[model samples]
Target: MRRRDVDTAVRHAALTFGAAIALMPLLWMVSASFMAPGEASTLPLRALPRRPTLEHYATLFTRLDLARHFLNSVVVTLAATLGSLLVTSLAGYGFAKLRFRGRDAMFRALALALVVPGQVGMLPLFLLLRELGLVNSYLGAMLPFFGSVYAIFLIRQYALSVPDDLLDAARIDGAGELRIFATIVLPLIKPILVTLAAYTFMAAWNDFLWPLIILSDSAKYTLPVALASLVGEHVQDTELMMAGAVVTVLPALGVFLAIQRHYVRGIMAGSVKG
Candidate 1:
């Protein structure tokens, strides 16, 4: 074979192998979720369930209190994502557009602070939440994300593209800063807002560590924490664990797939501007 042709064939084989390896775990998880309790672990470990059953799902809803955890995940994710978007967008726009002393230096400091690990502040954050009486509450789960340095940076980057002429016109019309931000800047940055919202939703929804730490009660467990607890208690039940994984993963996957176009666009825009 010609050298170029040989290289193309080898690359094709590599791609096919990599794709199969990546998909194998997901396939196994789905198959096991449908299997009867012990069927997933039988001698040969079948790739497909011998007999599919929804019994595990039924058990999850009826006996395992999965519904409550699902609700908690939803409420915390929505509140955090929305609240972060509003706060970050406003701050970002102000930093990008409004003139102020030490603005650039302060934003740079916040950007630098993003490099610090979240775990470094975990102990202090927990103590603060406790003092505020937010411990074990949904607000406690959502509070840490109300101010996001990365989100502010993203919004400021996007807001920099807004025309100065537009703002000047608004000011000439006697519009205040807040009014201009609400009516003009927001509509112009809708795509980035959607992108940021999707990011916050996915992050908050899949978060395991903070929720696990703050929420001591079973009633307030998010899906990931609840699934971990369930796995501990039901380790032998492979099918049940697989079902829980599916439930935990599906929402984030669905939301990503739905808004993926805008998400990709936002990333591209940020990269080019940077």
Candidate 2:
């Protein structure tokens, strides 16, 4: 082959191999989830289940109350994502567009605070929640994330592109600040908003440590916490665990896939501006 053709062939081969390697674990998880109980660990490791069954999934819903934890995960993720988006977007827009004393300094301080690890404040936050009687509640699990430093930064970066003349015109027309934000700023920033929503939803859905610490009751456990507890009690049930993994991962994957175009655009916009 010519040199250019050979190079193209090599690159294509490398990409295909890398893709296969990356997908192997996910394929195994899905396969094992369909295997009969104890079939996954037989003398010979089977790449595919000999007799595919939905028994593990049935067990998860019936015995483990997976449905309740699934609902809990959905509720907490949606609430945290929407709440953070609204709060961060409004704050970001105000900082970026509205002139106020000390605004730049405050925004700079908030940006700097992002460097501090969230875990550093866990103990104090937990104690405060306990004092407020918010522990063991979904609100407690989601409270810390209602205002995210990163979300504010992302929204601010996007909101900076909005024209000051638009706001000035709206004000001159007797539009209130909140009304302009609702009708003008929000609609203009829809792509970044969707991107932020997807990101926050994924983070909240996959969060393990905070929810585990705050939610004392099993009934309120999110998917990751519930899956951990399930694994502890049913270590040998590989099929069941795989099924649970599938359930936990699918929603976040779906959400990301659905909004991936906007997410990519938002990231590119922020990077170019920054």
Candidate 3:
């Protein structure tokens, strides 16, 4: 091959190797999840199951009650995602479209909030949740995600590009702010909403630390926390842990893959407007 052709071929080969290396752990997790209880940890370290079985999954659902944990994850993730969308979109649109004194200053202050670690507020947050009787509740798990500065920034940048004339025309026709938001602003911002939804959903789904702190009841534990529980309980069961990891990760992975095109477009669109 010519030097140019050789370089191109080498780059493709390097990329393929990098892809395989990145995917190896996930591949092993799936493979190990299918192996019999003791097979994956055996001498020689089998990469694939000799006889794949569903018993690990069966055990997780039936005996361990991971179904409940899965449901908890779904509930918290959906609630957080929808709540984040509603709140962040409204805040973003308002900040972008509406005029008020010190609005820019107020937004800058909120942006500065991103630098503060969430753990810094844990004590007060816990105390507040206790007072509101929201501890150990799904709503408690979701409340923190109801709005986010990054989400607002993204939507604000996108909303800035929306035509002022359209909103003014709607107002001239006597449409209320809520009505315009519902009918006009939302449709114009659907791509960014989907992007935000996917992000919020995945973050909520994978969350562990906050859920562990807020939820005292075993029944309220999200999947990641539950899987951590499984680690302590089934310390020797590699297959079971892998199964739990798969269960925890699959939905978030699926959602991201489903709307990745919209997510990418919204991101690019936001970048251009920004």
- lDDT tens readout by residue for model 1, 1-274: 9999999999999999999999888888988999999998889879888889999999999899899999999999999999999899999999999999999999988888777878799999999999999999999999888898888988898889999999999999999999999999999988889988877887898888899989999988999899998989999999999988888877777888999987777678667744
Regions of candidate 3 where Cα sits further than 4 Å from its true position:
265-274
Model 1 misplaced regions, further than 4 Å: 266-274
Predictions in order: lDDT: 0.90, 0.91, 0.89
Sorted on lDDT, best first, the list reads 2, 1, 3
lDDT of 3 by residue, 77-195 (tens): 99898889999999999999988899999998988887787879988999999999999999999999986888898899889999999999999999999999999999999878988
lDDT of 2: 0.91
Candidate 2 clash total? Answer: 0
Ranking by TM-score: 2, 1, 3
Better of 2 and 3 by lDDT: 2
Clashes of 1: 0
On TM-score, the leading prediction is: 2
Q: Which clashing pairs does model 2 show?
A: none
